[model samples]
Target: MREIQYEEFEEKIIEIRRTSKVTKGGKNLSFRVVAIVGNKNGKVGLGIGKAREVPEAIRKAIADAKKNVIEVPIINGTIPHEVIGRQDASKVLLRPAAPGTGIIAGGTVRAVVELAGIQNILTKALGSTNPLNLAMATINGLKELLDPRKVAKLRDITVEEVYKGVRREGNA
Candidate 1:
């Protein structure tokens, strides 16, 4: 198998927050970052890092993202089918769009699909609008995508049958 390098990925930071811990020695301050990394060729990842400084938090996030990388199948710069992902109270609905439509999404969803190399898509952010939850929900949706060839093999059918929705009676 070919190894994927982090250097090939583009990184985007979605959120940065300053957190405080009340302690006897005054308040301990820290930074939290949410980041996503992608290679724009069917691979992406999301990570969160917390640290005492911004750069450290970002660095940690990038490293964590690299470890959790996922493969996103892109068909003509869009997903092969519609999907919905849920993270806590946040639900993201992803639908493939016609060519030239571009990505119609909000902040977090845009970052994820763009990095995943999807060029045309429509999205709706339902329920909670929290950035962290929304980002996680997007990742979950992408993760649920299955390659058509793989699906055909699993169902003992041809790739054309998978696309045409023609299921073999024996297999069904």
Candidate 2:
């Protein structure tokens, strides 16, 4: 059996709802959990799970999140560029911000960014604010991030040249 690491115990439970289904005998109650998982280092995941008990539901959600973790590229403490992501009816707009901007995101996006160890970012929720959808959208946005190093390699330029251009522009 695969052992569960102690670190996996850490997770943010975004939302929990008790859902019931009517049956011939009466009603069956179930719990739904939405969770965000991250290593606080530009890797994050979101998961949703349903179970008869709240703890079990959360556990399942966390496991799913770990299995789905995505690596988000970070540059100068922020994303390399702006990105838009959508999941179902939820849309999220993510923009890279200068350092010290301090994560100007709301709700689920904020939690995701913080856990992903992003120090500066701007985000807007364009559609449904449902926690689950928002979380998933944020993850999708992060998945699309491209690092400056990768961009520099693609453009056949040194990373230092990229920063030098910005510095020159600031001084001018």
Candidate 3:
């Protein structure tokens, strides 16, 4: 058996609908479901499944999401830098914020970011707010994050010193 690492909760189905197509003999019906899965611990996944039954489709979507889990790096409870991502029609702009800023986001992007363990950040959703697209865009933004420590090492400077300079400049 495969072990499940994420504690799944808040399972939601969006755009649940049924459609029918007329064939030569009869009409064939199909169902579509969009599923969102998350651990509420800085890890989130999304999957879409289509089937004849709603329950089976949801189960399949959850399984697929689990298999496709992606790890998002967190720094000081926020992202390291600004990032722009697109998923279909959804375009998201994510920016890291200083401590105590809290999360500034809306719609599905908010849920994904919160679950991804981001505490202080800013986000803007452009183009569309379709749940799946927004979620995917948030994931894309998370994937582009780079830890401040890593950036500090790359620039050969201490993280604290970098912030100290910013503080000094802000107070001036």
TM-score, per-candidate, Cα-based: 0.92, 0.85, 0.75
Which order, best to worst by TM-score?
Answer: 1, 2, 3
1-172: candidate 2 lDDT, tens digit per residue = 8764535424788999999999999999999998888887877778888999999999999888887777888877888889998899999999989888898988789989988889999999998999888988888888887777887788667788765654444455
Q: lDDT by residue for model 3 over 1-172, one digit each (tens)?
A: 9686656555555456676789999998877666666665666667778788878777877677676667676777877678998899999999888999999998577767776678898899999887778878878877777766776788676897655644444455
Top-lDDT structure, candidate number: 1
Name the 10 consecutive residues with the lowest summed lDDT in model 3.
Answer: 163-172
Global lDDT of model 2: 0.85
| Model 3 / residue 152 / CA error / Å | 4.1
Model 1 score (lDDT): 0.93
Cα lDDT tens digits, model 1, 36-149, are: 999888999999999999999999999999989999988888998899999999999999999999999999999999999999999999999999999999999999988887
lDDT of each: 0.93, 0.85, 0.75
Residue ranges of candidate 3 with Cα displaced over 4 Å: 1-15, 98-100, 152-157, 160-172
Provide the lDDT at 128 for model 1.
100
By TM-score, the best candidate is 1
